[model samples]
Target: MTAASRPVALITGATRGIGRAIASELARTHHVIIGGRSRAAVDAVVAELGDASAFVADLAELSSIADRAAMLPELDVLVHSAGLIGPHEPIAEVNVDDLLQVFTVNVAAVHELTRITLPGLRARSGSVITINSGSGFTSHPNSSVYSASKFALRAWSDALRDEERAHGVRVTSIHPGRVATDMQQELRAMEGGEYREDDYLTPAAVAQAVRLAVETPRGGNIDELQIRPQ
Candidate 1:
């Protein structure tokens, strides 16, 4: 397909890790739009993908989302890959500011972006992919805050899936376990555990799951995909 006719995919947090892997994978079939907080990082990925472009904005800054979403009048796929893993601590000691920060980026931002882009997605009968985590289903001892955000994200995705089905739009939530990304590295550090790269799932593996969800036949939809390392 020619450039103008190709499907458009916008992947937030596309600067590195799972987001970058997803952008690269989709670039082969779609004109990828890389989204991230750093213009340089997004541009570098765009340069590497060749057929891709950049959308630089901080998801934490919710007010900027509307204008950024405006720039994309047509979007075939929206991937909510950007997230924040706030300080892992017990709920008793968690600061309100940190809780708000985590929820604002992980839940609120995702909702706003999806809301703004629903029309474009519905127009094309497109898909929305949420790069969720195992925490959404099961929260650990000191992971209450981060896990809460993921749980909320999962709930939103579930609600959106049913709400938009009649509109011919597909919504999917992908829950990946222990991916070997920078986030995992930081998580390991926080827990004072050894960083074992080989023991974790690769970013590309998670990206492939996303591709499958986005490419599923029109009549059928993948509500959620749970991926874990054997």
Candidate 2:
């Protein structure tokens, strides 16, 4: 198919990890656009995938998200892979900075980007995918801020799916257990925990799950996907 005939896929925090893997998978079948905070990383990924490009985006900064979104064209898929891990503490004793940053990226970013992208997606009957976590589904210790943001994201995705069903924009949220990526490592280190790599999932595996949701046949959708490492 020509450029216009191929579907457009946009992914955030795609400089590395699950986002990177997902971009590679989609680039095989669609025109992929990756959003990240690093210019060199974005250019590098774009070099590998001829049909893929990148936009400098910082989910923690709404202005950056807006600037990046303004330069992007309409996309058939929007994957929210950006997230933040907050300070390790109990619900009542959490750090305010951690809470603010986590909520800004995880919940607010999702809300703003979707609000802007929904119209374009609806016009094409596209798809919106958000990366969630198992923590959002159940309670966890020392991660109250992170869990809260994801919980908000989960609820937002559900409402988004319901509202856009008639417009043909399918909204999906994915919940995956510990993944063997830098995000996992950073969060574990922040929590003062050492998780076995063998017990964690790989970024590629999660990317496959995302691809399945995006590539589903017409008139059907994978509303929610929860992947656990066993």
Kindly give the number of clashing pairs for every candidate.
Answer: 0, 0
- Model 2 lDDT per residue over 1-230, tens place: 12346888889988898898888888899888878888899989999888887777778889877766766677799999988877778878976887999999999988888888777898888999999999888868887888888889999999999999999999889999989998888887877799678889988899999989988998999999999997
TM-score of each: 0.98, 0.94
Candidate 1 regions exceeding 4 Å error are 1-3
Q: Residues 68-130, candidate 1: write the lDDT tens digits.
A: 888785789999999999988888999999999999999999999999989989999999999
Note the residue pairs that clash in candidate 1: none
Summed over model 1, clashes come to 0
Off by over 4 Å in 2: 1-5
Clashing pairs in 2: none
Highest TM-score scorer? 1
